[model samples]
Target: MNLDPALRAILVCPQCRGDLTDDEAAGGESGLVCPACRLRYAVSDDGIPDMLVDDAQPLG
Candidate 1:
């Protein structure tokens, strides 16, 4: 399923509440990152955010 644009517009990183942008660089799997916290949240298959720190895999 595609991500909800409205939800994406308002979504922020849970750790820092910083603005998030589409992580197209990480393949089609969408993700958001907080520059301040250097934390990234991955979008689940169901379009829900997996905002756990452990869930974020380090960028290669």
Candidate 2:
């Protein structure tokens, strides 16, 4: 699912409250990565972002 530009501009990481950038791969799965927290929040199948901190994946 494609994220809306307007929504992306305002969505922040729940852990550090930092800006999130799209880290979508060529295969079509999408994630929102927070540079400050080094966490990746997964985007749901229906296009909704799962921004919950507990659900975030750790970034290497």
Candidate 3:
């Protein structure tokens, strides 16, 4: 599925408050990442962002 460009334009990393990118290969499966904080947030089944701190996984 094509990602919403508007969503991409607004989304920021919850941890670092930095810009976010659509990692298509990692999209849905691994969610989004904050390059600055190295945090990974899970994307919901409905494509909503689950931005809770506890839900974020440490980057590799």
For 1-60, candidate 2 gives per-residue lDDT tens digits of 567778877899888888888898558779999988888888876768999989988887
Ranking by lDDT: 2, 1, 3
Q: How big is the positional error of residue 58 in model 2, measured in Å on the Cα after superposition?
A: 0.2
Residues 1-60, model 3: lDDT tens digits: 243568867889876789765554444373777888877777765677777878888777
How many pairs in model 2 have backbone atoms within 3 A of each other, for residues 3 or more apart or on separate chains, i.e. clashes? 0
Q: Model 3: runs farther than 4 Å from truth?
A: 1-3, 24-30
How high is each candidate's TM-score?
A: 0.67, 0.81, 0.71
Worst 10 residues of 3 by lDDT: 21-30
**Whose lDDT is greatest here?**
2
* Residue 17 lDDT, candidate 3, scale 0-100: 86
Best by TM-score: 2
RMSD of 3: 2.7
lDDT of 1 by residue, 1-60 (tens): 357888888888776677876675436776777776766677777788777777775544
Clashing pairs in 1: none
Candidate 1 differs from the real structure by a C-alpha RMSD in angstroms, to one decimal, of: 2.4
